[model samples]
Target: MNDSLHTVSLIKIALYSAFAFVLSVITVVFITPFFPESAHDFLRFLAEVGIVLAVSLFIVRHLNKKDVSLRSIVGDTSVSKKMLLFSSSLTIGKLILYFLFAGLVLRFFITQPEFAADAQSVMEDTSPPEFNRWLIISTVVLAPVIEEFIFRGIILNKWAEKSSNTRALIISSLLFGLLHIGSFIIPQFIGGLLYGIVYIKTKKLIYPILMHVLNNLIPVGIMLIPAPESTEAFSVSQLIAELTPVLNVVSLVFIIALPVFLFIVYRYSRNLNDEVAPFKFNTRKAI
Candidate 1:
């Protein structure tokens, strides 16, 4: 378990992710065609879960080959109720920041008819009820668990062993953000960083996973709000106008609450650390 041989390289991480994605795609393609359209969503979900579980096991076994225990990677620290509460409050602040920034981008797009058309198209694409249902399950449920395990539970700890915690935080967050690609890059990246910090401070994989689920809940809740059944074409200004007031109020509240939440979390984290040292993986140990 020499440091030289302990690294989880970026290429390996990319390959692992791509392998899961490609395997899921292949499974869906091979299996879904035989099922009735009514059953496709459920079947697809099963396929995704199956593939992810299989890949996760494979990754764990691979790590075990190098003497890294899954328990160590996931950490041994106990999480407290107050810590979870403060962390969740901080996550709300992050979500508000996202919505405010999204509002700004929408406002900018309001000035450009061409961009508005593209935005309209994207909205239409996602408006399907079936798509929204699947998106909710995927985003709010599966993604937090799977992505947190891969990025924070595994990648961050291994990379910290190979390099340093700071570098591990930056690189893992960067990879997480890049996974979203396109316009989601910045927000997802920042979210990754926040989750990474929580993982480091709490030394518990469940904290970040729970926080990630909470962060996604707000957006999915908004998406689930029933829109008027209008046959009329989309209007960017109308959309912005309807959303602006709520976003502004929330953003203002977030601005005021964020610092308080940070202070509480910081204080609690310090107490937790004093009680039990934040677990670092034993990369130097061999079975």
Candidate 2:
């Protein structure tokens, strides 16, 4: 087995994820209660930063032992204006399609009250106002950097050493989806796949991170929008129930349009070599 693949095996990836989850639980269960409620969010944010740092240090230490610098795995490819625009457009189109399909499936196919409630629970973020700042910071900033580094930079590249890039992409993206399993699994899975593709095409972590930021920013921006006073407290289920008819029509349109949109994405992805990769980066050793 190659050194990179051996160092970052699937076992290590699972351990990394488990370590983060256990640490988070420890923070919430043990640490958060001691703090006044006002300080909980700040504490959680610090915990998140610590988790990222801890995981990163572990990865770096292992890779160094293998003589592989993190930067090489991350790649030093410079993203050009043209590649940036192309990647951004592709991400936006896929996101719109995902939103439509998700709405359709939830509103129409999944009709049992129990199942619907479970789905709604996944979508709902009931964090109080005190936590909003940290939530936003984590989602918009910490998430993209750490997640992209772990999934695309370390896991995907390491797996690609011993397996085909396609297999590595599927494995990395599947793990990514599971990380957000309860909350719109399909969309997260699709986003993972898209980010994986961007990483593969450009050989750069920055590209996928940029796309992830854009993906996350959309929901963050939506959350920031002031709702109508009357419906401010409505949960996703209630809102969906109220707008069922309109959503059904929109879903129908999306169902019809989805195939065409997918075809465009496929074509664009195939032509990415022409759009990106006109330049290259000399890989020097760096963490």
Top candidate, metric lDDT: 2
lDDT of 1 by residue, 1-287 (tens): 32332544446656776788788888889988898988888877776777667767777667656655666656644779997886797788777666665666655555666866776777778545635466468779988988998888767766765676667778889988998897468878878878887787767888898899998888778777777777776576677666667666655665676676557546644533222212353322322
Q: Root-mean-square deviation of each candidate, in angstroms?
A: 5.1, 5.5
Clashing pairs in 2: none
**What is the RMSD of candidate 2?**
5.5
**Alpha carbon lDDT of each predicted model:** 0.70, 0.73
List runs of model 1 lying over 4 Å from the truth. 1-17, 109-129, 132-135, 228-287
Segments in model 2 whose C-alpha atoms lie over 4 Å from true places? 1-6, 106-131, 230-245, 271-287
lDDT of 2 by residue, 1-287 (tens): 12244555557756886788697768677977777988887887887778777877777777676666556666765789998997888778777877787778766655666766775776575554432688788898889988888888777766666666677778889989988988757777788888987787777888999999999888788778775444366666676577688778779978898888778657646744233221122133231
Question: What is candidate 2's local distance difference test score?
Answer: 0.73
**Residue 255 of model 2: what lDDT?**
84
